[model samples]
Target: MDFLTLDYFIKLFNIILIDLVLAGDNAIVIALAARNLPKEHQKKAIIWGTVGAVIIRIAATLAVVWLLQLPFLLLIGGVLLVWIAYKLLVDEKEHNIEAKPQLWPAIRTIIIADAVMGFDNVIAVAGAAHGSFDLVIIGLIVSVPIMVWGSTLFIRLVEKFPVIITIGAGVLAYTAGSMLTGDPFVKGWFDENPVMKWAFIAIVVIGVILAGYLKKLSKNFISINEQGQLTIPDSIKNEAQIEANDSFEAKVDDQGRIVLVKVAKSEG
Candidate 1:
């Protein structure tokens, strides 16, 4: 496919979308792994970890065409993708952020977790790429920074508006179902009966909702920083909210949670 064509652009978009959805947990893992390192070392860990992850995903994507050629492999991957989507919707354990301040260990942890957890993500990206590895490479290159750096913002958004997470889960479920129907073993079956494709999608969507409800019964939504390792300082500097000329006072608890934030009176 030509890089400048509309079909290629659409595939690139899908690849990027799949990566972002799959990257939320990865961002958290990176943060937790690097939290204990010195500030400079933390940066290094994120850089190297991201580099390693990108390389690993690229290599995996490159092998997708060959791997998918094996009988039943696509079906097995689709089943795994459904399970991963379910876990993404429901898993809520707070990762232990306290660790030795060694940088290499942190980087290793990030890489290992990323490699293990990225199976479904890699599958989704390969499906999106549609055998065009160039699209996969371009998409990952654009998305790695967002996954590495924008995790905090994405976490906060999910907390504030949980529907985002639900939508994300739905997207993953759709991908799983799509892959299942497209698997070569069953592709002929679905191709003959177009309605069966939508039926599989409905089944996957129902599965996601049911699994989420059951998991919710045993889980509680807590602040991401409930362990006190993550902190948010209350400071605002914006054109409409608070200018650089303005001052503010922030009240932080012992756990570093911001309890109050208010504009301070100017002291002449």
Candidate 2:
């Protein structure tokens, strides 16, 4: 395995950008949630929360790396990642999670929020990593501090230079293309037709950018009750075919982009 190739560096760089853009949001949420705690507890909450979140991220990325090895899953994951990249540009949902009053509560909030809000982050990183556990580990390790302490600096940087996001999304699109190339069913065909292979990747990268610009950003903001219980619109529930006891997986990032996906009945 020659690791000095330009392709390797591109993937590594993609992982770095993905981590930089996606990691900071989690950090901001932790800081805001921990701010309500006492000084000593705040310190502990930040420390433990960072550790717990990083650990879970590591596990999740590893799981994705393994899953991508399955036949045709790489192709599916790549398509999903393309949508995720597009959503990274336009999907902004807010999670009105309450900051806890106590130390454990605050820490728990940070961890839970990280886990919930981290769905895209995890999948994006895994896609960029391209089954390289080294890249995955490096990405997570490099991102931990950013997610824990560098939220404001990154937030400011992104605000000042919004193009940075486009660059990151492009990198994600490249990885998505790579996934399709690596798909077991298509690998041989692409290997025989290198020109067509590059063409497909270039198309995926260009298509994501065009779609991202042409589509409007969707707004899905749901408010929580005093107890942090969310009230879904009856219309939404009906459209989604949600049952009275349906469960959801909810996450909120620093930018306050909240996502709520209904879980399967068995999983619920």
Evaluate model 2: give its lDDT. Answer: 0.80
Off by over 4 Å in 2: 1-6, 93-95, 216-268
lDDT of each residue in 124-241, candidate 1, tens digit only: 7776565666787899888888777886787688789887767767767776787778778888989999987898789997888689877765453223465654222222223236
- Estimate TM-scores for all models: 0.70, 0.77
Residue pairs with colliding backbones in model 1 are: none
Scored against the true structure, residue 110 in model 2 reaches a CA lDDT of: 87
Whole-model lDDT, candidate 1? 0.74
What is the lDDT of every predicted structure here?
Answer: 0.74, 0.80
Error of 1 at 208 (Å): 2.3
lDDT of 1 at 231: 28
What is the TM-score (0 to 1) of candidate 2?
Answer: 0.77
